[model samples]
Each structure stands twice: as C-alpha cells, then as structure tokens.
Target chain A: MAILEVKNLSIEFGGLKAVEDFNLSLEKGELIAIIGPNGAGKTTIFNMLTGIYPPSNGTIHLDGENLLGRKPFQFAQAGIARTFQNIRLFSNASVIDNVKMANTADSNENFFESILRTPGMVEKERQLDEHALELLSLFGLEGQADTIAKNLPYGAQRRLEIVRALMLNPKVLLLDEPVAGMITTELDEMAQLVKELREKHGQTIILIEHHMNFVMPIVDRIIVLNFGKTISEGTPAEIQKDPRVIEAYLGGGFHGNA
Target chain B: MKNKLNSILPPVVLVLIYFLIQLLLSKKILNPYHIQILMFACVNIMLTVSLNIVNGFTGQFCIGHAGFMSLGAYGSAIITTMLFGGMKMDPNLRIPVFLLSLLVGGILAAIVGFLIGLPTLKIKGDYLAIVTLAFGEIVRSTLRLIEPIGAARGMIGIPKITNLAWMFFFVMITLYITRNFVYSRYGRASIAIRDNEIAADAMGINTTRYKVIAFVFAAFIAGVAGGLYAHLMTFIQPDSFSFVKSNELLVYLYAGGSGSITGSVLGALVLTIIPEALRFLGNLTNWRIVIYAVILVLIMLYKPSGLFGGKEISFLRINRDSFRKPFNKFNDPKLADKQNS
Candidate 1:
C-alpha cells in the first residue's frame, strides 16, 4: 500500500496554473525520483505537498489520512518533512543547533523547566545533544558541528540540511534538488547517502532532481513531468526509453507544455 | 572542569560587588546622585534584556516596548494607589497590596503582547514595525484621555515600594530566565524562525507559536520593569513611557549585539553609564544624545551584527596537547550511505 498518495492535485496562481491535475503515490520505503526541466513545477509540487502553499484543488493523503489544508508545520507534525532547493541553514547558529531545532517538538523541555535547570532539563539537553551529534556524524560532520553552519563547504552545508530534516523523524522525506550545485564527486556522495537513507532508515523519499545522471542509480521508480503535469511514471529503465519524455525534453526542457 | 567554574565566577563577583557598593552607598561612600544613577542602571538592564527576546532572538521589530512598560507601570501603580495609598480606607494594606498589583500589571501587559502578536504575525517587512509603533501611540493617547488617572497631569503620591533588593532580584530572575530560554530548544526554534521561517516551519516547528511566545514573554518582563519604575520613581505619567524610551531600549539591544545574553547585560550596563559619564561635557549636555547617536551608527556601519554579534566569544584556547585525540571516531563517508540512501 502507498504511504503517500496525491490525486488530481492542481494549484493556480491568479490566471496561471502552476500545476494541473498532478497525481502520484509512493509505497512504504520506496525511493522515487522526479525528473523535470526548470519550471516543470517540480518545486511547486514539493511546496504544495509540504503545505507551504495550499493546492487550488485535489487531495493529499498520507497514511490513509487527508492532508489538505494543513499548515506546513502541521504537515511536518503529521510526518512529512523536506529540505529546501536553496540552502536555508540558520547562518549564525552552530551546525548542531540547526538540526537540533527539528527535534524540538519531540523534546520535553519547556520554558519553565529550562529556566529552573531541573535535573530533567539537563538530561533532556544531553539526550538532544547526543542525538544531534550522531546525526552530524552520520553526515561526516561531527567535527563541523561546533562550527557555524555558514562556514562549512558547500557540499557539507547541503548534507547538514538533510540531517536537520531527519531531526523531525519524518515518515517521508522530500529532497528538492539535493545535489543541485555540487561537483560530480559530491553528487556521487549524495546519491549514495540518499540510497542509504532508504535502505537503513526505512524512509520513503521523493527526490526532485534536474541532474538525471545523479538519479539513475538511486531511484527505484521515475516520474517525468513537463509544464506542471506528469507526463509519465514508470521504472527507471522504462522512463529512460519513453518516447513522449524525449519529445517533452526536446520541446522544452522540464519547463515545456504538458 | 574549568568550564563550570568559569560560568559561576562572574555572577558571584557581580553579586559581591553589588552589595559592596550598596553598603558603601548606605555609609555615604558614594554620593546620593551616584547611588541614584546605579539604581537606574539596574532598571535599564531589565528593559534591554526583555526587549532582546522580541527584537533580537525572535527577529521581530518591536518599537512599542515602552508602551508595554508604561501599561505595566500604570497598571501596578493604579492598583497600589487605589488599594493602599492612604487616600484609600486602608493604609495598612500598602506593601503587600503593591506587590500583588505589580504581578497583575505584568499579566495585563502579557495579554497585550498576545493581542498585538496575533494580528501582526501575518504582517512583516516594515508593516509589523508600524503596527507596533502605532500601538505605542495608541496607548499613550488613551492614557492621556483618562481623567481618573489625572490624564495629562500624571499620577502622584504613589508610595515608593521597589528598592535595591526587589530591583536586583527581578533583574537576576529576568537575566536567568532569559539566558536559560536562549540556550533551550524553544529558544533555538525562535532564532531559527527568525533566520528562515519557511525552513523552520518545514522542520515541524510551529513558527507562529514560537514567535508569539517570545513576544509575550518579552512583554511580561518589560511589564515587570515598568512596575519597578513606577514604584521607584513614586510617580507616573503618559509621557514617561514614550517613543524615546522605546528607542533607548533599542539602542541598548543593538549596542549589546542581538546574538547572546551576555551582550544584553553588558550593553545595558555600558549604555546606562555613558550619559552620566559624559555629564562632564558641561554645556554640551545636548551633545550627549549626539555622541550616543554617532556611536550607535558607527557600530552599525562597521559591524552590522553588533558588539558581541550573538554568542559568548570564549577567548580561552584549547591546549595543543588536547588535540591529540581525533574529534569523532564515528564519522565516516560510509555512514552517509547507511543513513541517506
């Protein structure tokens, strides 16, 4: 059974329809890749799915529950988490703090407890710090955890965004161009990381990548989009051979007419 | 081992120094004028740190801090005066009634914070600033029109109740609570929301909830400071908590650096002393404002982040021998594959 389902989802901004009748689904632990040209409304789908922007119409169901009208934070609480297409780390905060924030809601520490420095607050802070360090270690960033997030190398910053999202312990993780500006070596590293997240963490991931070469090995299923609508959905091999995808790619990159 | 000692040392020294000075003041070691100056410095510390929570940590531009302060001062004063001001039937109820009234005032101010925070949450990018400013103006104007409180004439004969002990106690509590909050997860969320709201929300943080919480808490502290001011001065007026007072609080926060608790305390202490220290300028009294304005502008231009920027900068360095051990044994590129893939 699908862990996430999107049916007839459409979003319009005034006179222009950014996404039209979009549909897709993911079974538990599936690693699906979304490939599109710029303006294919790929990020818009991620945005709508995350509730940053409400869809004009259609239903989003997660774990058999309707997800329409929920705020982004509410969507997160309901087990959906995502990283931005752009790096949005708290530039002044320490690297560990950037991720620790994601785990705040699960924490027992509150205003009163923290002010008094109760034994409970101390233990909670220690637990959170340990988990944050472990997450940083998973990304090979333990050394950089004490460093300000903005000072890290570009690739490390991207990895930090993922670790921060993992702080939410989400059921489904959305990566919006996770390896967008990295070099070939960095992309390779990220591709492997995305694979492990699914294999070891049992996280269902929907990755939007313009870098087709990066997605080829990691994706189990591939969905092709053009001009705000899904043009095709299939196994990675089938998507690679689809003639319509070729025409769509030729007519316009991912930004072409649906 | 040294880290724990380092944190504890400053507060112990500060407390000892404060009482030493207080004892000296009682014995007329320092002039009464200087004692008065010291008391005001403590009050300024309360105001600056409280405002930091809203403007600095939460990243909200709140220019109406003085309004909340005034509301607290007037609320507490009015309650105390009506219940125990000798004009009332019971002169015996003075001290306890005044203390209780101050708490009441703080709660009212917090309610005001919540009310203002809710409507302005959706408004940002200068609109929020204007809303806060307008709220301040509205409060002052309303206070002026209230004849029962003597309107433009101001309220007087409110017996002095806040003294050295109460002022320092509140100051310590405010600083302690604020410092703790800043180091907690909620505090981090507040800063994260400030840094990037969309990103914070996506991480499952309730951005609106945190923002409102910071604003209301700041308001409560500001209110307490206000209550203290009313009792300390033994007088109150609409004009006392005006836009100028708000700007003064801003100056303290900005000069201290919005990044850390230490900045607020240091900023408050230094700025409080500046005006009096410059009193030697004699006829150039008006130039004191000019000097302050210049210093603040220079700081902003050279270091847009502020004096401390945000966190405590530890000048202490790690021993070279301590680096012999690797920082992390578990960090491996292989781990990324285990987690990300």
Candidate 2:
C-alpha cells in the first residue's frame, strides 16, 4: 500500500483553477521529483498537502488516514512536513531554537512541570537540547547554535530550513525548490546532501525543483507538470526522451500547421 | 544531586534578596519617598512584563492590558469589602485570604482575556490592536455604568494590604514565571508564531493555542498587578485604566526593550522614577513628561529593538554555564556564524 495517496485533488480560486485532477500514489521511502515551469501548480500541491490550502475536491490519505479536514499543525503531527520555496526560519530566534521549535508540540511537559523544575522534565529538556544539537552538528550548525537565524549566511539558512523540517519527525518530507538560487558548487553540495538524507535515513522525500541539474541526478522518478496538470511521469531517462516534456520546456515548432 | 541544589538555588536567592530589601527597610536606610517609588516601579514592572508576553513574546499588539488590570482590581476589592461585608477577620488568616482573593481577581481578568483572544484568531496585527483598544474603552465605560462598583465616582476605603514586601515577592514571581515561560516549549511555540505564523504552523505548533495562552497568561499577570495596585492606592477609578494608561505601559515596555525581562524591569523602574526625578526641576515640572517622551523617542530611534533587544541576564537562565566564557569573547556566536556558515 502507498504511504501517501492523492486522488482527484483540485483547488479553485474563484473562477480560475489553480490545480486540477492531481493524483499520486507514493510508496514509503520513495523519492519523486515534481518539475514544471513557473506556474505548473507544483507548489500548490505542496500547499494543499501541508494543509495551507484545503483541496476543493477529492481525498488525501497519509498511510490510510484521511487528511482533508486536518489543520496545518495537524498535518505535521500526522507526519507530513514541508520546507518553503523561500527559506522561512524563525529569523529573530537563535538557530537552535528554530530547529527545537519543530519538536515543541511533542514535548509533553506542562507549564507547572517546567516551572517547578521537576527532575523528569529537566531530563526531557536536556534530551531535546541533545537532539537539536545532534541535528545541528550533522549540518555543521553546532558552533552557530546560539546565533540569530536571520544573520546566518544564505546557504546555512537554507540548510537550517531542511534541518528544521527533519526535526518534525516527518514520514513524508516535502522540499519545494530546495535549490532555488545557488552557485553551481553550492547547488551540487545541497543536492548531494539531500540524496544522502534518503540513502542514510531512508527519508521519504517529494522534491520540487526548477534546476534540472539539481533534480535529474537525485530523483528516482520524474513527474512533469504544465498548466496545473501532469504532462508526463516516468523514470528520468524516459522524461528526458518524452516529446511532450520537451514541448513543455521549449515550445514545439508549428511549420506543418502554418 | 547537584541538579536538586541548582533547582532550589533560585528561590533561595530570591528569599535572600527579599530579606535584604526588608533589612534596608527596617534599618531606615531608604526614605519613605524612595520606598514608595520602588513599590510603584514594582507594579509597573508587573504591568510591563505582563504586556510584554502579548506584545513582545507572542508578537501581538495588545492595548487593553489596563482593562484586565481594572477587572482584577475591582474583582479583589469587591471580594474583600463587599463579599466580606466589612467583617473583621482573624489577623493570622487575613494574608492568605487576601492573596487568594488576588488570585481570584487574576483568574477573572484571564477569563476576559480568553474571550478577547477568541476573536483574535480571525483578526491580526493592526486590527487586533484596534480590537484591544476598543476592549479597554468598553471596560472603562462598563465600569462607569455599573453603580455597585462606585461607577464614575471611583471606589474608596478598600484595605491597603499591599506593602513593599508583597510587591517585591509578586514582582519576582512575575519575573520568574515570565522568564520561564519564554524559555519553555510552549513559550518557544509562541515565539515561533511571532517569527512566522505559517512556518510555525507547518512545524506542528498550534499558532492560535500558543497565542491565546500568551494573551491569557499576560492578562492574568496584569490582573494580579491590578490587585496590587488597588491595595497600594486604596482606591481605583475607571479613568485610571484608560487607553492612555495602556500607552504609558507600552512606553515602559518599549523604552526598556520588549522581549527581555531585564528590559521590562529597567523600563518600568527607570520610567517610573523619571517623572518624580523631574520634580527636582521645580519650575520645569511639566518638562518631566517631555523628558520621558524624549527618552522614548531616543530609544526608538537609536535602538529600535530596545536596549537589551532579545538578550537577557546571564544568571536568569537555567544553565549557569551558558555564560561562563564571557571574558575571552573568542568564539562570539553572533559574529562567527556568518563567517563559518
């Protein structure tokens, strides 16, 4: 059975349809890439999946649980976590705090428990710190743990975004344009890191990327979208060879019609 | 265990500080005027810290703190005077009863805070600000209409149970609780909501739940402050808790720095003393208010984040070792992160 299944999912803003008939059946530990031009409704799918925009029609199931009516935080609790196209760390907060925030809902200690400094609560807090620090050290953010998030260099901020998402303990991680703007070296490094996440942790990831260089090598399957509909879906080689995918990226010639 | 020792350390230190202040009082080292100023500053600190939870930690602008304070004042004052029916209680039981009444008053204001926060789920930013301002005005007028609580004439002859000792204890409690809240998981969620509502929501943080908690908690503390104020003055009028008073509290919060506990303490204390300190100007008595305005403007312009911004005192944190390497400054977290990352 698929870990995540979306059938006939659609959304409309007034008279215009932003996305329609979005269907997917994603197995556990699958890494799929959703690629498209500027307005192909890729991000829109992520929005609906993360509960930012509820679907106008159809049902979404995460490991057999209906996800239609759940709130955004409920979506996260149900094991769906996502990063934005634009990095959205808690900018005014410390770097560690930004990561630790993902685990807040799961931290069971109450206000009085924390206030009175109960031994068990303090131990729990220590574990949280250790966990956050562990994640930070993995990304070389340990030394910068106490620094303000917004002041970090651009690449670290982007890394912290994904790191924070992972801290959510998600079953299905959504990466929206993870390599939006980076020099070739930085892009390659980020791509390698994401692929490593899947290899080492078996992290199930759905990637949306414009940079084909970043997308082509890492993703196992490529799903192409144009005008809010999936135009092609296949292995990377098949997607590279498909005529419709070519037409979507570069407009087809019309000599015969003329 | 060492941890047990550490846990007890803060309360023990607090008690020691209380006794030290009491010693000064008993020794007659400080004048009565200075004592009055200190007590008033403690009240303002409570108000500032309470307001900071909503305005600073949660990043929601609340202009109706004084309304919650008013409710608290009226609730407790009535409990002692009207509910008790002027019957003299045993002296030994009086303090506890008074404290319980103050708690009841705080709870009453918190109920209203929760109600106001319900609408805030739909409203945001400037609209929330307007809603809170309206709440303050509505509370004021409603008090005026209710003749049982002295109406527009104001209440009088309430017992003056608040003293320097009680003020110090409550103010310290306010500081301890608020500081703990900011550092706790729920408090972190509140800060996350302030940072980015959508992102915080995506991270499984219930933005509304934390927001309302921050609001209600702030209102509860303000209510406590109101109880203290009512006892201190032995009187309270609807006019005292107007929109202007709310703004006055904001001035202290902003001038001291919004998110920092030390900021609230310094802001409330220093700003409280400035007006009286200006009395020394004699003929330029009115300039005291202007000086305050000038100081606020200066703080706003030169240090928009306020004096301390997001930082706090070292010892206030749970981990004593967090600030151990202050002297070397070699591994400055703020500067080094930009270069390393």
Each candidate's DockQ: 0.51, 0.50
Cα lDDT tens digits, model 1, A174-208, are 99989988988998899889888899988899999
TM-score for all predictions?
0.91, 0.92
User: Top model by TM-score, which number?
Assistant: 2
| DockQ winner | 1
Q: Give the CA lDDT, 0 to 100, for residue A223 in model 1.
A: 86
Runs of candidate 2 exceeding 4 Å displacement: A250-258, B1-29, B83-85, B318-341
Q: Report, to 2 decimal places, the DockQ of model 2.
A: 0.50
